[model samples]
Target: MSSRAPWIVFGSALAGYLAVGITLSLRFGFILGDALSRTAAAQAVLLSRDPHVSAIGFIFTPLTGLAQLPMVAFASWWPAITRWNISGITVSAAFMAGAVVMVHGICRDRGLPGRYRILITVVFAINPMIVFYGANGMSEAGFLFLLCWAVRRLIRWVGTDDVHDLLLAGIALGLAFLARYEGVVPIALAAVLVAVVTACRRGREHWKDMRRRAVLDAVLISGPGTAMFLVWITTSWLITGEALAQLSSSYGNTAILTQSGGASGDLVQTTAFSLGAFIALGPTLLVTFPLAVVLATRRRDLEFVVAPLLFGGVLAFQAGSYITGSTFGFLRFFICAIPLAAVVVVQLFPAAGDLPTRRAGAYRRHRPSCPPMRTAAAVAAAVLCVSALPVTAWAMLQPSLSSQQYALGYLLAGDPSAADSEATTARRVIDSFATERELAAYLDGQALPDGSILVDSVYGFAVLAASEYPRRFVIPSDLDFTQILNDPAAAGVRYLLTVPNEGRGVSDAINRRYPTIYDNGAQLYPLELEVPNTGADQPDWRLYRVPS
Candidate 1:
């Protein structure tokens, strides 16, 4: 493998994705609320009055926030980075660039020609799901980076019996959990695969000895991920008082999903819901998927099994989750299938120089029927990979398929009528960002002492991040947040920034504490301002004064 190939892929991808991200964010004012929330959480670590690592919040996995720290640190002076969520874009772009490099590595490892490697990598890089998530600063890009890294390492370990490869794969899967909660699916599947492969490798060994070897090898491959999983829960329990706050907290996933009225269908409906997303973004899965599964069974090859189980397992888990009403049917949710399919392409039709398989195949008698048949499949895979781009671009404009940014597609196509009221309003959505600035400006002018303005980072993260004086606000990340929230007036908190008690807003800390506070200040506090939500994807904010 040429060492320079990865750098070329990474550098080009980084530059191209950064350009798209920055243009969409700065030039067109397109940004994502989830991405902004991550940036806000990262800022809590360095800019909050408490200024502790734990300030990064516990609801979401920590690595994405932790990953933003380096860029988030600059937000103090480079306000635009946080204001426009540019720092998040930078992080996502970098991770996605790295993900593309992993896809390139798989192509090389499978002995694909240089041109085919370039084609596979390019197809993955230019996919709409990849480009959008890579620029949007969500955890998907980083999660994909870790997932792809782990997949390549797993394939290498399966072929070479390299402990180092196994360990590296395990470590990546471990960190992948910190990137996205769904990572647990891969970690579990990888362990099972490792055990199966290890046991099957024993030919003349004792049954007990083979069993022992299989168990140890499985543990070795999965130990890091298991440990990391424990560490994450322990950390969250310590700070948030709930081990799975990301799921159970009032401001957590279940609360938000319920509030948004998500998971609107039965099992079959949800399955179709998920499949539509997968088909739109990962059309290449159509061919590679069957080929991957059939080849592993036909050849009984452990190496070929890596693609279907390691990567395809995650895809299946997402589909299952949707079918079970565990996750929303988002286009980006099935993005890993893109790389899974690309890797399967290489596995299905590796060229003669595929070193790993060549060495392992010493015991095998199976071969392709003829070179022409293999060539035909390889060409078809490449064609599908290229075709996925336009197919995805078309899918991105359909709101039912591309829930997150389908409006952007319509807006770009100059068909504003095709988009909904929210989309029409979102094209000029910077008003909400400015509204946060205005609110922060008002709070900063009051010269509130530290912990004077009580707000939950769940929804108020935008205002907290926009403020020049973040210390003036007492967020959940604060060491004394619970104390201040209990009796704001007694705790010297002068103001409460709250959202109306409706939908997800009711889960906001303030609304829960004073259920009727948003309506009439609960007769205990005076309403100071009613800031109407001026942008899409945001709730109207209510500022109330706590009598001291």
Candidate 2:
């Protein structure tokens, strides 16, 4: 086992993936502090029975947070791994590590060169999408690992025409499908390619061979695959009386749209911008995909690598439906596939014809010689690594810098007597607690007994802040704050909070909607006076009395 020689490939992959994973996580992981999206995902889970959300009911709802129960369980029991940002960050990294080992083993079995295997593994490790998404709680990282493993297995089977490999490939694809619905596109593409190759080889004679082998592979893989999917479906059905209804509801919800024409335009803009962003990430990928097309024509060398690229493309296409302007997130969706494309590009460089060559399977084989510039290779690696520095640094710093700039804007425009007594209230608001403490403390001082408080934040805060008063602070399903202001029931709100920096237009609108009752200037607002309800620039809230 030690002499099998793929461990070097595994080690190199682990080291590179870990380095990129840690670097990205050091910044992206902690920015929200304890402000996890628990409400989004958890609410989906809780309301799994709601018809609108039922389409997604079978699957663990991501609207709450990134990690699934299985993922959380694994992280919790794993020694030296805490179930927080850093630990959760390792989930995708660990999956990539396993994928690298699997791919290395498969390549070694195919008698690919050790050096080549190491090189491709490194390429996979540094793949931008892989590094970015794998460290995130998002499902894309796990899906990529499963999809890549399946593709490698499928290709290995096609190259060798081994039933064991074929069956394993099916199982891997099946698992990939369970991980992400988009995985089916890649699996179908792979199956079609394999079937076509088998048919052309011996005509009718090959037909039977292909059918029998494919059937056996499908049966073997489908056993576990079907079971995994059924579990989610059955649970969703039991909970919501329909399989995937939560997902369907979540997918179909478009109530946020202000106008149909505007929404349609937004969708078009999203698709165009997403495509532009993907192209910008690497114009080389558009070129590289054609190489995949050319390579796919080689029946014996049929790498299922194209499957993932196709699947990613399919997912990218779906980004058009996202009305919330989340198209930028699609870049991370295609990140892992970029490195694979780079590796295939590297493989296309023809081996020097006149160089010293060792016949395949020679023990301690002669290194394929003739490239005299070892320094050039080292320089190339250094250049690629350093080239990413500017981007990595920019991505890490942009959020923090933008937040600081935003705080400054608020500070300058904010009124001292209305918001807070001090002029520096804006900075204090920015520097204050990263958790629910600030909002909770402000509510506690109001002494209003058991009624909803409206705030523009994710629902998790609403739940946590109101834990002492169950169902007191419900997230208004109808987000018409204008209507809430006029309604007598809402006019008596005990505590009104605004995350002026985080919400869309709520920051500017808040100041415009309410008169300043009392302001310390920056944050401490105590309502001691009333003024006309004219929509002019004012403090965040103007409390109107409810006549008894």
Candidate 3:
């Protein structure tokens, strides 16, 4: 195979998806909130009144925002980048396309035929959920990329016992930890697999030797990720005085999940919801996963052990998190399962030509005496993968199944009626946050002084990022935020943006300081305007003119 084949696949995939991302932004106003919020944080590193590195954030892993920093820093020159969140879209599309390259590389390392590699990549790429995350500027795309990269290297290390491959895999996961906290599950699992595999292969009689080498290899594989996690928490603690702030902070994942009522469903129902999500995106996982384990057990083909388990472990961890009230019931959490299926499919089928030399416990090209049955099996696997697309598309359109996916689904559905609804709250419900943009524009027109507006970033990140004059507002990241929140009028604060004190809005600083601020300005300020919450997904915002 040409070394350039992966680059060609990457460039072609990137170009196509980057176009999809741009069109999604321009036509339907489709963008993910987490992406927007992360991009806002990235832009605030320089664009905010505080303009410090700590402005990036304290809780959620920072890689997604750090990846956007370069493009976000340029947002001043290209206003559309931050406003439309093209910076995030570009990062996601490029990372997703790189994931396509890793898919090809994984298949190739197992010596699969070119045609099979291309087939698996296409089937993986065409899944609507996959493409949506790739083009919509979410962390899932980057997480998928790093997950595949780690799995690919670990597969090689398990096959060849190359220390270099193991080290690179650890670094990929270390970076993945920065991408999403879910990376911890796979990193920990990978370390266990390394230790167990080493013990079994390296020591037949010398138990002590086996234990020592296994422990060492496990440390080599696990060290980087563990260190990264510790450093991240330490940094959060140093900055915010709260370690694991993502769980304890008012703006953290648990807070958001509790606030949204997402954790209120019964465990059995949520488990059922999880299985349905997996089936839609990775139906092949049902068949190929078992096949990988069977093949690994029978032929000592350890490549299958590392790849499937790394991806599968993450999926299990996410499903468990949702069931236990630790996270939201989002279909996107299962995206890793799609690539897991792709890796398994490529291994299940025989290549067009056998390898010149085979490594023991590596991939064994399955050779069935009945050639026709082999072809039939491969065809059936491919069919199972392709069939998932329509099921995934159907699932995305169902609000009960995927409220996060509805706007893109409506646009992709291509119904003229659905497109028309873009203006009627269908698109703006979550993605557009169109009212926030209108508020930003309205506020920009006023002669508001610097530090005149007081709003909590938890709810006001979008409006602040969208504003042409961002520094006019005094946000939580500002140094004097605590002092000013106590008595805004005396601190030169003029306007206050207050959301209804419900759900996630309960933590808003303004609401906390004066519980009746939104309803009656707590007898200290006057209501200037009320922006009705667009889709009932967010709170109705009340703008107050503080008596400064």
Candidate 4:
């Protein structure tokens, strides 16, 4: 393999990602709600006086926002960068490029030929879900990058038994945890695998020495990540005054899981839904995954099998989340498994002829006959390759079938007027936000007294996007809206912008507590004064003046 091959692959993938990021930003304008929220949080971190209070809590981890601070600060100085959220999108794309590079490195480390390495990198870079998220302001890309690096480091550690490698792996996993909560699974899995593998190798030659090393490896792999998780939880508690603020809140995943339906039927339905979504996103994985497992087993290659184990672990975690109803149905959740799947596929065919025959005494004693196993493995690989070829070709042809497309289709499915084209859906999304943009413009024009406006969660992004003084508006999404309304003066709320679609409980309570001063399908009730609407969308926004 040429020394420049990985860099060539990385540079090409980065260029492609940047182009896609720019195009998607211009066309869709950051369509995902989560992306918008993360953008808003990044802005809060950089621009707000009180970031801990102003930024949305629990649902978001802070690393992505913190990472965006430099770009957000730059954008503040140069407003043109804010046009397409170039800063955020660029950061995501860069991380995605890093992920592709990591994939190439992992393949190379596993002794895959340069051609196969390039093929895996190309396949991963062009994956629709990966491309879509890579072009947006989301954490998935960043998390995947960290995850790939961590896995690579662990693989290196296992092969070389270098404590430094294990420590680096732990640090990467810790950072990954900060990027996304699901990172804990990798940390835990790595720790257990290290302990198990080390213990299995123990013998009289160095019994105590091997046991000590095994214990050290386990601790090194898990310690930093676990400590990071606890620190984040502690910080959340101190800031929000809830020890488990990230988990206990009504908006948190734990609450969602608790409220979700419980039954064996729900489990089965969710599992099927998750698998179906995975297939839709990456159909080639279905063949590649099992084929890799068969090949690895035939060769008795412990390191090769780790790829499948890691991929399976991620899938199982997602399946468990779905069954428990802790997560919403989304294709992005399955993304972590994509690179591993690519590794599996690329190695499956090439490794067949490179099978290692050496085995331990225990394994040699119980090993199955070689000829039949080899023949079956060969046949399976052939079948998988043939089946996967058409699917892979189809995937390459339809590189634009992304999670955003699926989400937009689902949203528009109920609207009889929505056209089937991507342009139409993108336009509809922009049009839907027209009210928000207008409301934001109106609020900016008002130049209302500081700490005067209180906003519901639904309009948080709109307010942030459109307002000059976004931090001035109080968001009651994580708090009790009724309490804020009981003494509006005490809370320094002079006006309220109510969007009935969000937080029905809060909307209902506010409507009951105060008389309606403005009702346009979405009602705006005044606690003290009657403030008339000033040319905003009637059905989408209602503005009311609160009596001091």
Top model number, lDDT? 3
Clashes of 2: 32
TM-scores, one per candidate: 0.91, 0.57, 0.92, 0.78
Candidate with best TM-score: 3
Scanning candidate 2 in windows of ten residues, the lowest lDDT window is 356-365
lDDT of each: 0.79, 0.43, 0.80, 0.62
Residue 467 accuracy (lDDT) in model 1: 76
Least accurate stretch of 10 residues (summed lDDT) in model 1?
Answer: 361-370
- Residue 142 of model 3: what lDDT? 89
RMSD of each: 3.3, 10.6, 3.6, 6.8
Model 4 pairs whose backbones collide: 528-547, 529-547
Query: Higher TM-score: candidate 2 or 3?
Result: 3
lDDT of 3 by residue, 219-314 (tens): 988899999999999988998988888889988887888777758569788899889888877776777778767765765566777766888899
The candidate with the higher lDDT, 1 or 2, is 1
The reply for model 3, stretches above 4 Å from the true place, is 350-374, 412-431
